[model samples]
Target: MPLDAKTLCLGALEAGFDTGYDIRKAFEDGPFQHFQSLSYGSIYPALNALLVEGLATCDVRNGDGRRDKKIYAITDSGRAALKAALMEPLAADQLRSDTMFAMAFVHLMTRDQVKRILDEYARANRRLGEELGRLLRDRMCEHPGHQFLLRLGEDGSEMWARCIEALRDDLVAALDDTREAPEAAPTGGAAAMTARDAPETREPGSGSRPGPDPHHPRDPR
Candidate 1:
């Protein structure tokens, strides 16, 4: 099931992010990096909805000639809501990636373009892996479950980076082979090979035990 922005924001608050910017940053730099993303477009409206529902409160902190900052905090009602949500049956996971889609049609792209794409992909995964590793090394969490989740995220990021690097090497070698055999016609076997070598469309988070589904009302577990 798709998670709503509002519940994710509430979870961010419960996790100690006090501002909308901080909540969004948490998604980019924290555990959510592995599985989900929420933009400012989603965040601000979610924050507003939470306020309207009386589940959270916000205080405006004036800045120096820039935009004022709003600090948010969960209320008692918000805590209850979060607990209820967490206790509910977890939703089915959904994975969506434009990178994977582009890679599926990689045969149509030039070697240079493929190189650029692989370089960018490797760079991004490497950065995420490094950040996750640093977070695990420097920060300590009291909750065993949270710690487990953090470790899982770190492992996933590192593995993804390594896999992407391996793919980059393979692609480079394949391109070189193709250049050396320019007269050879592309074969059906090549299509089969590409299909076999393509990355899994589903992301890493799907197989994990279910968590709360924020979009729907609680159902009996």
Candidate 2:
């Protein structure tokens, strides 16, 4: 006797609420708590489908607010459906991410591959940091709500970027001293060469055969 989580979340938006945090709290310790709570996985898709159904529209503010956040709002049809959906039963939810599951096996990979992953991950984190910094500096200041959201995201990104950089630097330092080519060990033939015979030379037009070329400067007559 519960409404679908997606519909319920959209209804909340129609009731002058939007943003992921607002919807999450609306479900937290509420009637919708009986159903699975929303996450980035659920929220983004639900919002997109809502827009496709003409039930919502986003208000993207460009340039900056103080911390730049693009806000979303709901539409008229969204309100009527929200009321109707409240009476309907909630559908079951599925939580699956293959990428995350694959990452659990990262330690099983070769060291070189792991190092590459770390470097790529650090660069990606740094890019996210730069983008978030730009957003905070350009906008998000006008409203306390938006400013808080921007700061929240920025702080999280900054922390991750720093962690990634530290790990990558450590890996690079470890690799530097470990990559020298091993000196060719003295084979039995090389040992015999030093003991019994002078170093053999390849004659002109010879096909990789070792020969005694006395005419060579190193081979005395």
| C-alpha RMSD in Å of predicted model 1 compared with the true structure | 12.8
Instruction: List, residue by residue over 74-137, the lDDT tens digit for candidate 2.
Output: 7788777886675566556564644336445443444466567766766765665566556667
TM-scores, each model vs. reference: 0.66, 0.36
Q: Which residue ranges in model 1 land beyond 4 Å of their true spot? A: 59-69, 143-145, 171-221
Candidate 2 lDDT score at position 70 = 46
Q: Give the alpha carbon lDDT tens digit for every residue of 35-93 in model 1.
A: 67898999999999999999999999899899999999999999898888888887887
- lDDT of model 2 at residue 45? 79
Colliding residue pairs in candidate 1 = 1-92
Candidate 2 — what's its lDDT? Answer: 0.55
- Kindly report which residue stretches of model 2 are placed more than 4 angstroms away from their true locations once superposed: 1-107, 168-221
